[model samples]
Target chain A: MEQARPQVDLEAALAASERRFRLLADQAPVIIWRAGPDKQCDWFNKPWLDFTGRTLEQELGYGWAEGIHPDDHARCLEIYTTAFAARERFTMDYRLRRHDGVYRWIRDNGAPYYDDDGSFLGYFGSGIDVTDHVETELSLRRALSQADQYDQQQKQAQWRQEMLIHELNHRVKNTLATIQSIAMQSFRAGVDVRSGLAKFEGRLVTLSRAHDVLTQSNWLAAPLDEIVQSGIEPFRTPEDDAFTIEGPPVCLPPKMALSLAMGIHELCTNALRFGALSARGGTVRIDWQVTGDGEGEQLELTWREAGGPPVHSPGQRGFGTRLIESGLAREFGGKVTLDFAPGGLVCRVHAPLPAEEPPLVGGLVVPHH
Target chain B: MGRRVLVVEDESLVALLLEDMLLELGFTVVDVASRLETGMSAAEQAAFDVAVLDVNLGGETRSFPIADLLRRRGIPFVFATGHDPSSLERTYPDAPVVRKPFLRGDLRNALARALAG
Candidate 1:
C-alpha cells in the first residue's frame, strides 16, 4: 500500500511539470518548434501555428515542410537533417511561406535538447523574420558601389585638369622665350634702336591679333580673309585705295593663320615704306584660290603691287623679307617666289591644302581609328 | 670660317635670335629646322660641328628622336627646353640642357661643354 501511494504522487508531479511547460511554450513570442530524432517536426508553439495559420495536426511530422519556400526546401531540410543526425547546434537563413501567402526571410537556430539523464531528446529551434534586415543590407551594398564609381570619375576629371594646366604652363614659358628671341633679333638688326622697338611692338601686336582670332574660333581654324583683314585694317586710310584683297573662303589651321598674319603684316609694312602704298596712286592686290583635285589639291596665293615707285630689289635681305619668304615657305611646306619686276613687287605662294577637317587643338579627346 | 652649328628650333624668332647669337659667338649657322622631319633631314644632309635641339616640339613630335640620330652619327647636341631639367635627365642623362630664353653666355657654355664631351 505505501509503494502504491508514492507511485501515485510521482505521476501527479510529472503531469504538473508538463502542464507548466505547455503554458510557457504557448505564451512565447518567438516561433518555437520541436523535431523528433527522425528529423520530423513533432510539435510547434502557438506562435508557430499562428504565423503559418495551420492546425496542430497539419503541422506535425513532415506536413510542416509545405510552408517552406520551394527554392529553400531542399537546403532547409538538409541543414535540419544533418544537425539532427549529429545532435549538433545549427543556424541557417531561409524563406518560408506565411499565412498571407508571402515568402519572408527567416533565421532559424536549432540546438539538441537534452533530458535530465543527459540523453538527447530532440531538436529545439526558434526562427525570426529577417526580410527587412536582408533587404537593407543589399541596398547599402549597391550604394557603396555607386559611391566608388563616382569617386573614380572625379579622380579622372582631376587628372585631366592637371594635364591641361601643365600644358598651359609649358605654352606660356614657350611664348616668353619667343618674345625674348624677337626682341634680341630686332635690336641686333635695327640701324636705329627706336625703329627696332617700333617694329618689335608691331610684330607683337600682329601676333596678338592672330591669337584673338584663334581664340574667337575656340583655337580651331581661322578664315584666311579674316586674318588678312586683321593685319591690313590698321594701315588703311580714308584717302587710300592702297589695299585690294580678294580671296575665296579658306579655313587655315592655327599655326598657318598665325604665320600668314605675320607675313601679311610684314608685306603691309614694306608697302607703306617702299612698295605700291608708298605713292599717292599706289595700289596692292591680293588674291588666292584653291587648285587641283582630290589629293593634289593646293592653295595658290598672290600679292601684287602696282602704281607706286619703281620697284627695286633690295641689296640686303632684312628680317621682314626673310620672314615673308622663308618663314611662310617652311611653315606651309610650300614654295614662295619673289619677282621684283620693274613694275611691282610680286609674290606667289603654292601650298598643299590641309586634309579635310583637320583636328583642332583640343580635339585630341576623340579616339582615332 | 667658324665652327658650323645646326639650330633646330620650332619658333622663327627664336631660331633667328639663336642664329644671331651663334654668329656673334664666332660660329657659322649651318641650317635652322622648325619641324622634326625637317630637322632629321637637315641632320642627315647638312655639315655641322654641333647641334642645338629643342626638347619639346609642342605637338606629337619630340626632338629626342633627332637627338638619337645625332648620337648615331657621332654628333654632339645640347637640349633646350622650357621644362624641368630633372624630367629630361632620365632619358638623356649625359646631355646638357639649356633652359629657354637662356643668356648668350649660358648657351655658349652649354655648347662648349657638349663639344668638349
Candidate 2:
C-alpha cells in the first residue's frame, strides 16, 4: 500500500513538471519547436502558433512546412534533414509566410535534444524574426554602390576640368604671342607710333568681342550678323542709316568668326577715318548670300560704301588693307576683291561655308525679315 | 644676299612679324605656311638655309612632321613657340628653340646657333 502511494506521488510530480515546461514555453518571446526523431515537427510553443496564426493541429507534424516560402522550402528541408540524421546542431535563415500573407525572414537554430539516459529525443529549435536586419543590410549595400558611382563620376569630371584648364593656358599663351606680334609689326612699319598704338588697341578689342561671341556659343560657332554688329557697334551713329547689314542666317566656326571680326573691324576703322563713314551723308552696305549646291556651295559677302568723297587706292598697303584682302582670303580658303572706285570703296569675299549641324531645340537662329 | 629661311606659323600676324624681323636681320623668308600640310610641302620643295617652325599649329597639328622632313634633308631648323623651351627640348633635344615675342637679338643668336650646329 505504501509503494502505491509513492507511485501516485511520482505520477503527480511528472505532470507538474510537464505543466511547468508548457508555461515557460508559452511565456518565452522566442518561437520554439520540437521535431520527432523521424525529423518531422511534432510540437510548437504557443508563440510559434501565434506567430504563424495557426492552430496547434495545423502546425504539428510537418504541417508548418505550408507556411514556408516555396523558394526556401527545399533548402530548408534539406538542411533540417541533414542535421537531424547527424544529430548535430545547425543554423539557417529562410523566409516564412505569415497568415497575413507577408513573408518575414527567420533565423532558425536547431540542436539535438536527449533524455537523462542519453537516448535521442528528436530536435529542439528556436527562430527569431531577422527581416529588419536583412533589409537594412541590403539597403546599406545599395547606398555604398551608389556612393562609389558618384565618386567615379566626380573623378572623371575633375580630370576633364584639368584638361580644359591646360588647353586654356596654352591658348592664352598663344594669344599673348599674337598680340605681341601685332604690336611689333605696327611699330616696325615706321608709321605714327600713336596711330599704331590705336590700331593695336582696336584690333585687340575686336578679338575680344569675337571671343565673347564664341564663348556665348560654347566656342563652337557664332552667328554672322552678331559678329558684324559687335564689330561695328562702336562705329554706329544715331543717324541709323549710315550703315546697313543684310545676310542670311549663317553660323561661322570659331576661327572664321574671329578672322571675319578682325576684317570687319579694319574696314570700319578705315571708313571712320577716311572712307565713307568719315563723311556725314556717306553709307556702308554689307550683304551676303549663300549660293550653289552640295560641295559647290559658297558664301558670297560684299562690303560697299557710297555717298562719300571720291575713292582712291592707297599707294602703300597698310596692315588693315592686307588683313582685309590677303589675310581674310587665306583664312576663308577663298578670294577677296578690293576695288577703289570714283564714288566709293567696294570689298567682296567668297568662301565655302561649313556643313550645317542638326539644329537643337531653341537653337541660335536669327529670324530673317 | 642673305640666307633664305622658311617660316611655318599658323597665325598670319605672327608670321608677318617674324618675316619682318628676318628681313631686318638680313634673312629672306622663302615662304610662309600657315598649316601643317602646306609647311610639309614647302619644306620638301623650298630651298632655304634654315626653317622656323611653330611647335603647335592651331592647337591641333604639330610641326614635328615638317621638322622630320627638314632633318632628313639635312636642313637646320629652330622651333618657335609659345610653349616652354624645356618641353620642346624634350622632343627635339638637338634642335634649337626660340620663344615667341623674342627680341631681334635673341632670334639672331638662335638662328646663328642653329646654322653653326
Candidate 3:
C-alpha cells in the first residue's frame, strides 16, 4: 500500500508538470514544436496549430512539412535531419503556409533537449514570421539596380552633350576663318578701300541670313527655295518684276545650302551690275528639275536672262567665277557653266543628288508676272 | 625663288587666304587642292618642299590620307585646324598645328618649326 501511494503521487506530479508546460507553451507569442528522438514531431503549441490552421493530429510525424514551401522542402528537411542526428543547434529561414493561405518567411531556431540525467531526449524549436524583412531586402536590391541603369543613362547623355559642344567649337572657328578670308579679299591691292568695305559688309549680311535659315533647321538641312528667297530678299525692290524662281521641293544639306546661298549672292551682284536686272524690261528665270533615278539622279538647275542689253564675257575671271566653277565642282562633285551670249548671260549647274533622302515639304516658289 | 608648298583646303576662300599667306612668307604655291581625292593626288604627285594640310576636308572626310602620303614621301607638313590640337597628338605627335583664323605670324612660325627638322 505504501508503494502504491507513492506511485500515484508521482503520477499526479508528472501530470501537473505536463499541464503547466502546455499552458506556458500555448500562451507564448512564438510558435513552438517538439520532436521525439525518432525525428518525428510529436507536439505543437497552440500558436503553431493556429498558424497552420491544422489540428495537432495532422501536424504529428512530419505532417507539418506539408505547410513548407515546395522550393524550400528538401533544404529544410536536410538541415533539420542533420541537426537532429548530430544532436546540435540549428537556425534556418524558410517559407511556410499561414492560416490565411499566404506563404510567409519564418525564422526557426532549434536545439537538442536534454533530461536532468544528461541524456538526450528530443528537440525544442521556436519560429516567427520574417516575411517583412525579406521583402524589404528584395525591394532594396531592385531599387539599386534601377539606380545603376539611371546612372549609366546620365553618363551617356553627358558624353553626347560634350560631342555637340566640340562640333559647335569647330563650326564657329570655321566661320571666323571665312570672315578673315573675306576681309583679305575685300582689302587686297588695286581695290578701292571704301567699296571693298561696303562689299564686305554686304557679304556679312548674306552670310548672316544663311546662318538664320540654317539655325531654324537645327543645322541639319534647309529647303532650297528658302535659301534662294533669303539670298534674293536684299535685292528685291517694290517697283519691278524682274525675277522668276520655279523649282520642285528640294532639301539641301547644310554645306550645300551655304554654298548655294553664297553663289546666289554672287549671281545677284552680277545681274544688278550688268545682267538682266541691270536694265528695264529685262527678266531672269531660275529653274531646276530632278532627273534620273536611284544613284544616277541629277539636279539640273539653270539661270537664264532675257531682254537685257547685248552682253559679252568679262576679260578676266574673278572670285565669283572661280567659286562657282572650280570651287562648286570640286566640293560637290558637280559641273557649273557660265556662258555670255549676246542676248544675255546664262549659268547652269549639273550635280548628282545624294541618295535616299526625302525632299522637303511645302515648296516656296516665287512666280513673277 | 623660295620653298614650293602645296595647300590642301576644301573651302575656296580659306584656300585663297592660305595662298596669300604662303606668298607673304616667301613660299611659292605649287598647287591648291579642295577635295580629298585632289589633295591625295597633290600629296602623291606634286613637287613641293612642304604642305599645309587642313585636318578636315568637310563632312566625314579627313586629310589623314594625304598626311600619310606626305609622310611616306619623306615630305614634311604642318596641320591647320579649328579642332583641339591635342586630339591630333596621338597620330601626328611631332607635326605642328596652326589654328584657323591665324595671323601671318602664326602661320609663319608653324611653317618655320615644321620645316626646321
Tens digits of lDDT, candidate 3, A1-369: 977998999999999999999999999999999999999999999999999999999999999999999999999999999999999999999999999999999999999998999898899999998899989988999999999999999996686566566666777788899888778866878889898998788777877898889788866677888888777777888688788999998877666677777777778888888888888878888889989976677878888888888898999775666555645665667898889988888989887766743222111111111
Report per-candidate TM-score of chain A alone: 0.68, 0.71, 0.75
Q: How would you encode candidate 1's per-residue C-alpha lDDT over A1-369 as one tens digit per residue?
A: 977998999999999998998899888777889987777789999988988988989989988889999998999889888878888899998887889999888888999988899887889999888999988988999999999999999997787676666656666777787688668756774359998898788888888888888778776678989898877876789775578888889887776677678778888888889988888888889999999887777889898999979988988776665665545677557787778988999888787776754442222332123
| Runs with alpha carbons beyond 4 Å of true place in candidate 1 | A1-128, A238-241, A292-297, A356-369
Give the better candidate number (1 or 2) by lDDT: 2
Who wins the lDDT comparison? 3
Ranking by DockQ: 1, 3, 2
Q: Report the candidate with higher lDDT, 2 versus 3.
A: 3
Order the candidates by TM-score, highest first — what do you get?
3, 1, 2
Model 3 residue runs over 4 Å out of place are A1-45, A55-97, A101-103, A107-126, A356-369, B1-4, B10-12, B23-47, B57-62, B87-91
The list of candidate 2 runs beyond 4 A from truth reads A1-50, A54-94, A99-102, A107-128, A272-274, A278-280, A294-297, A325-327, A356-369, B1-6, B35-51, B55-77, B83-87, B110-117
lDDT of 2 at A43: 91
Q: For residues B1-113, what per-residue lDDT tens digits would candidate 1 score against the true structure?
A: 99889999876666777888888999999888888889999999899999999876645457988999999999999998887889778988878899887788989998999
TM-score winner between candidates 1 and 2: 1
